[model samples]
Target: MKITLIIPTYNAGSLWPNVLDAIKQQTIYPDKLIVIDSGSKDETVPLASDLKNISIFNIDSKDFNHGGTRNLAVAKTLDADVIIFLTQDAILADSDAIKNLVYYFSDPLIAAVCGRQLPHKDAN
Candidate 1:
């Protein structure tokens, strides 16, 4: 099954690296990694360009709203079977996280599933 992971970012330099690294570490990488930036005034775009296997989109609007940016990103990937939305600050642990999420979709009745976020030991 094809899955698209959408990560909406805005001046997310402080956390974007961790999120990208986490995605790279995933055992079951997303078919497509969409990084939607809302005119970030940092090196976020450059950093995203350095990553392999990622699709980056820059929203050039002067006005920025989180939901609007996400909606735009979602519109860009309407063909995907599943859309996994993650924030720029989110760090995915366990390489199999994506795999696990996809596994749950095996049940026809399950529309969506979300996992809990626990503080990383290093974050303490």
Candidate 2:
């Protein structure tokens, strides 16, 4: 099954690298990776520039509508069997994170699946 990952980011300077590393280690990497950035004035764009299967789209920071931005990414990867929504701050719990989420879809009854998110240690 094909899976696409969509991330909405803003000023994700320090955090985006970790997010990219985690994506690289996923048990099953997404067939497509789309990052809709609201004009981050940092290295967020450059850091993601050379990654495989990744496409970065830019928009005015003020134009970001949480739902609309994600919808735009979804519309771009229509052939994907699943579209994963994530924020820049989210780090996968383990390599199986994406693998497990997609595994659930093997059951035809499950139309879509969302994974659990735990607070970052810094949030403590």
Candidate 3:
């Protein structure tokens, strides 16, 4: 099944690179990766652009609404069989995270799935 992954970013901070790296290292990468970024003064847009196969769409910071931004991203991925949404700061815990999650879709009745989150290893 074709999978599309969308991440909404706004000044994602220093951890952005790590988040992208973790995604790139996934055992099963998304067929399409899209980043919807509101006006960010930082390097969020540049960093996302440097990655191949990532499509970036910009919106005014004032127009950014959590739900609306996500809906916008979804609009661009109509052809995908599965769409996965992740926040800019979310770091996948392991290479198999996406692979494991997609495996659940094999069940015909599973319409949606949510993954668990754990604190970072160094969280205080």
**lDDT of candidate 1 vs native?**
0.81
- List model 3 lDDT by residue over 26-104, tens digit each: 9898988999999988999998887757899999999999999999999998998888898888899899989988999
Report the Cα lDDT for candidate 2: 0.88
lDDT of each candidate versus the true structure: 0.81, 0.88, 0.90
Our model 3 lands, by Cα RMSD against the true structure, at 1.5
Q: How many backbone clashes does candidate 3 have?
A: 0
After superposing candidate 1 on the true structure, give the runs of residues whose Cα lies further than 4 Å from its correct spot: 120-124
Question: Model 2: which ten-residue window has the lowest total lDDT?
Answer: 115-124
The candidate scoring highest on TM-score is: 2
RMSD of each: 2.2, 1.1, 1.5
* Candidate with the larger lDDT of 1 and 2: 2
Per-residue error for 113 in candidate 1, Å, reads: 1.2
lDDT of 1 by residue, 3-113 (tens): 999887788867678877888888877788788887889978788776666789887757557788888888988888888998777788778888888888989999998
Score residue 90 of candidate 3 by CA lDDT: 86
Pairs with backbone N, CA or C atoms under 3 Å apart (clashes), candidate 3: none
